[model samples]
Target chain A: MSYDFMSVQQRYIEQIEAALEGAIGSEEETLYGVVQEAMRYSTLGGGKRLRGMLCLELCRLGCGEYERAVPFAAAIEMIHAYSLIHDDLPCMDNDELRRGKPSCHVRFGEANALLAGDALLTRAFEYALRECDYAAMGYERGVRGALTLAQCAGLDGMIGGQAIDLRFENTRQMTPEVLGTLHALKTGALIRAACLMGGIAGGMDEGQLELCEKYAAQIGLAFQIMDDILDVTATSEELGKPVGSDRSSGKTTYVVLYGVEESRKMAQECVQEAKKCLHDLHIEEPFLYDVAEMVISRTH
Target chain B: MSYDFMSVQQRYIEQIEAALEGAIGSEEETLYGVVQEAMRYSTLGGGKRLRGMLCLELCRLGCGEYERAVPFAAAIEMIHAYSLIHDDLPCMDNDELRRGKPSCHVRFGEANALLAGDALLTRAFEYALRECDYAAMGYERGVRGALTLAQCAGLDGMIGGQAIDLRFENTRQMTPEVLGTLHALKTGALIRAACLMGGIAGGMDEGQLELCEKYAAQIGLAFQIMDDILDVTATSEELGKPVGSDRSSGKTTYVVLYGVEESRKMAQECVQEAKKCLHDLHIEEPFLYDVAEMVISRTH
Candidate 1:
């Protein structure tokens, strides 16, 4: 079961980094500088870049080339980075640090940080709309992918999840169902979107898209549950954030609700189920398989 | 040349109020509830619905039907309301009160408020998309209208304006040029979007759409400058919130930078220019003419 996690991680990271560098451009306008800086500040600092990598990896696995999904991969990362920036605001998580550096608002004043997040979120779609090769795949697919990302990031999905999380904070107890709903939204929505965008970018058929959706859903949840476990088991140095910060914020976690052993078991099952969906896909990449495992094992 | 401002204001307000009542739906789902409440809080709280009225008035003046433009009028207001909700967040303007009521975040908590804003924004497009019949005109016109609204609300337009506003706050003494740039974004972008949306919604020709854009740009700046003036001259009772609040925040303003007399002159010029664009159109409605004047002259 053991795999070369380090090499796979490095390869995915390199691919995502290269894509991002190619996607962003230097334009000299007053407004462009503000937007470019905000986007760079939020995205350049490295976390796992897992969402971007997953998008690329899935595109490769589903099709043959990773380049086709570059816009979507970059877009997903922008969305994730913006969410992190907003989530760390003084009114929200209030953390001073992210990925071992000062959070966006701490580095760029609160107003710029807020604007940066908003700009990044909006720019993601603009990038998709303007840069995505609609001609190659036809306008309908491109428009659909852009619309999907918007819907997933907006009300019924990621934002809804954040709202629910905020509402549930400091409550005495939350049902497992409610916690699952929250995770599906706050974290799962974007992850699902990353995979779906990859599928759409790759021009996968409806059946393939469905398979990707199921696989993404499983890995997304498992990734989040692993985060819950790490909050308790890993140190701030290893996690690159204050350990048990979720608990301190009075937020519920899978580990807290289901216990560490059961949480781990559930995460394993999720990874397994996700893999099962890919069983018939004829995927050739060993790296994508390794990524699914890494999703469950990441400390941060 | 002074006219009956009070009656004109009342009539416009009444029109917008009735329109909004029909636009918002009462739904029980948590997501829908948030959207409905935010729309009501932001749109129905007794501030003059000048934006919506402008859309209606411009449609009439452009030789289009008010009935045909009503949905667009409401949609533009929804977009405006969403911007205001997000702008008032602790990370942005952090305003505690809006139109005499506790701001969306203050009353509903930050999470719900954020979701509400998001829902309203998404629903705006949904509203426009559904209204894409173009009545008996054509599908091309309907599609064009929807796309126009989307582009305006997206990064290149309203979102871009907000980005510039965020970047400029508390950092620099804004020049008149900078003030124009900011107002063009913060105010003119959406106003232009509203006019264009209404024109296209009513199947207006290219010439008409172009004329409406000019008209909207003029009144948009006029409206914003007047707002800046009232922020200094009007009291909380008149404005439905504390006046001079922008001054207290140390934000840049038209009046602060240009002085009251110059700002008024600029607004007057903008209105004149807007009217001149429509001189050859041969508009039928006198109300539309009154609105163009009233928009520049309003105190609160």
Candidate 2:
């Protein structure tokens, strides 16, 4: 069945944008407002909102109201945004541009950017826990969802992945296993979290949640491989940031390990695997397939 | 009424240290274990475990076992350690020494330090939530305590205070009120969280929690005033950090607004008020008073 993937994506994007705008407080005249301003600038600047979309969609597919997932959707996006801000810091990637604009540090100064990243991360938890606890969402599910969020964003997850990335930079020890570990933690972890938390929010059972994790793992890996390909193929303008940075920095991406053609085939295989996982569960949402397809075809 | 304050303090410190040591995992041989190393380096290398002591003492005083508060006590100290790591970053305070040893960024690189701080903060929530949900702690109290942890460490709290401090640095517009607000958010918020969360862990009702908050607020203020005074009166060796940093940076502080003599008197008054708060609550915890006294008299 042909699905209106573009329209659905657009709708989800709009919902996510509105939720994100509302999630962050308005800029105040107070001295501490600068961090808030920096937070808004980065979080609301621009992106695919892919993480938020996955969360909302997964929640809807799990027979839960998508609206119930909006807070978490906004949260994952905020987390993604904060990671980007920190990733672009002078001490990290040192990139001055992100999403076609000056990075947080470039615009707000380094200290404010650092604090903004810190604030955005802390605020994400607050927004998440707002819908949790003794609220409509049961305590067990809320705690589980929160644990997923914290773990994915914590030492054994995204931060750990960054550490690996930094350790192996410009080194010849970047093996397939190391690269896989890096991608899984740095990027895949959050993606899986978005999926798992969405399922948890929808009150899915352990089996269903396991299926969600499997599907997310496949797509997340595919997404990173495609990202590696796009870094080599897409223009700087198209990507909204500097392209070929991985190659310039001698970062061992999928495209570096396997050539462009081989990487494309690998990503396609992962997407196929992802779709099969969804199909095994008889998910009514054909849009999940479309999202997997987009991961392979996405240019930026 | 006399308490063996020294022995009790020593015992509590030992408990906190052991808890903190156990809370953080050992360094792994994997690529990402370096972040864990940095996390341990900063958290284990500590000064006074005052926050943890308050949490445990309050829990015990509220008719709950102090052991129940150990997880939270360790969590607060982790949060505190992370803040110190970030504060001593080159872009922030630029301090090379923390607790008379090299700061995280100095020992680890700036990027690693940043990631280590992020990891610690995220890990704090993970550890706190470990005892929540369907656990012995009722979901209501668990959620309340977690919310307290998030809020106090968040934008309107410690991070917000840091923003204000950065904004007003070397500026002449820092009034007594602004300084008060900064101190309340920066240092007082976490101290207050320690007290309130400790009370929450003990299942204290709203009224009892209010008393804990009042006592904490007074002590937190007194603590900062003493800190300001110590910055001038104590030697760097005694403080474990550079003295006269405020004056050198031209940063406005309690001592900046009110001279050393006045600040000392103000701190003493706050301690008196704090004691009254406990007395009115009919608390039997004489160690609480001792802890309050240490805040004003501490050299570091």
Candidate 3:
């Protein structure tokens, strides 16, 4: 690799942060203005911009301008942040701390936090429709990219997965198939969409897009497996919030089924498959390669 | 005026219901499948399909096929249903009934209701992107229409108004201007978007679009005013829920500020202005005119 992966990741993160700020702000002071404040608090605070970065890199690798993907990248990040806020709600995960600070509901109150999540999710489409142009990619490509986003975020995707996750919370009878489907819908769907949308923006043909999807699917599962491994091995300080949360919640995870050693091996295998998929795409950019590696190897 | 208004409304309602069903429904049922069931219950049940009818009618008036507007129409209804579901949450209005049936959270639980709302909201865009083609409406028009939905649904629109509504729940110090902004954001924004999207679908010029917006703005406010009037004058049986809810909840409504007489006057004036705007748009169908009149005259 000619360029440093850390530097590249930092650049995308900064771009995503700036874009997110520009997309949401209040010009007038009103009681309603607190909505924007809650939105900003959850979104602007530091976290891994993995979703947005994947989108940007995939768009570039797909032959589209990285700039054209910035709005979309930021939008994806907004969706992620909203999911976190809602996930931490008193009724959901009941989490109080996020990024080592009070969660959105903790600071903004429950109602405002909920609205903030709703606002973020809605604004994602708003930005995609108004700012991100298919003309920069292709008209059809733009439409498809946005559609992919909505689909991945909808019932058959993230929401569906979340429902299953919440339902099977205390049941240790989670079959491997259900666990696989659960993670695929909950997290894999959106991650797959990020890469696929980048491919669409790059004007990738059906074959190429399928390859992108294949790569994203592997990395997405691998990413979750690594997360499970980290929960067992990593310190609370390193993991940002409490470690062993999955265990406490009794949430079925890769580590829960396959011991630590096997989970690590599985994540590495998935990353290897992801790299091979990237290689089949016939582009020699090492950026995505490094990203897939980071997904498996990262401690947090 | 030759066609029966009831029949026209029935036709559109049926279409919206069918489209909504097709847009949602999981082929494979899982333990988590109740999300779709909850979505169907709140959405497919009986109610005025007013928002959707507006989109379809405006599309027809603007010179587009009403069928082309069906998917978008259904999407708007999903947005409305989602707003209602979230609005009735324990943290929000805590209502237990809607359209003579148990509120979604009542039947499905708070967590599932929340996910159902989120799913419906997400699926609205999915349907728009996947099924509603601008080829019948022009690509830019399609994009603009979807964008309108997002903006109306986002922080600057419905979510923004809802946040303020929740914040000022017990505070009776709402000024008229603040009240206006609140209603405009809360309900007027979505109504306005419905009309405008119909116009874009119909290929309306800028002047025609502006006329639609003007007509919508007045009718939107009138619609809310009539809602306030019903709250005070109508019975619980007529409303299919608790009447005088605004008073009991300490919600500072238009009727609270202006009194029954003045609020009635304001609503009538809005209807008259809306009819004028419709007239100025050179629409002779009398459908929109009757709809505007219906807005003020409906008892429940």
Query: Over the stretch B13-99, how does candidate 1's per-residue lDDT look in tens digits?
Result: 676667666655555477235545666777664656777776766665555456666667777787788888999988778889887
List, residue by residue over A1-300, the lDDT tens digit for candidate 3.
468888989999899888988888644586678889999999995988888888888888777568878877887888888888988988788899898889999998988998999999999988877778666776667777788899998888999999998888898879999999998988898898788877777778899889989998998999889888999899988877899999988888889899999998998899999999988998787888999888987887
lDDT over C-alpha atoms for residue B130 of model 1: 54
TM-score of 3: 0.97
User: For model 1, how does the per-residue alpha-carbon lDDT over A1-300 read when each residue is reduced to its tens digit?
Assistant: 465668767777787766566544443476636666666866874878878877777777656777777787887887788888878888777888888888888987776776667666655655666666666656557666766777777767787788777777798477888898889988999988988888887788999899888888898899999999999999899877789888887788998888999999999999998888788566655766677898887777
Per-residue C-alpha lDDT of model 3 across residues B1-300, encoded as one tens digit per residue:
468888888888898888888998643567678888898888885778888999999998878468888888888999999999998998888899987778999999898899999999999999987888667777777888889999988998899899889888888888898889899989899999899888888889999999989998999999999999999999888888989889987888999999999999999999999999988988888778889999988878
Question: How well does candidate 1 score on lDDT at residue B268?
Answer: 91
Question: What TM-score would each prediction reach against the true structure?
Answer: 0.84, 0.97, 0.97
Q: Residue A184 in candidate 2 has what lDDT?
A: 93
lDDT of 3: 0.87
How does model 3 do on interface RMSD, in angstroms? 1.0
| Chain A TM-score from candidate 2 | 0.96
TM-score of chain B of 2: 0.96
In model 3, the runs with Cα more than 4 Å from the true position are: A26-28, B26-28
Native RMSD of candidate 1 (Å): 4.6
TM-score (0 to 1) of chain B for each candidate:
0.89, 0.96, 0.97
Q: TM-score for candidate 1, please give it.
A: 0.84
Q: Report the poorest 10 consecutive residues by lDDT, candidate 3 chain B.
A: B24-33
C-alpha lDDT of candidate 2 relative to the true structure: 0.87
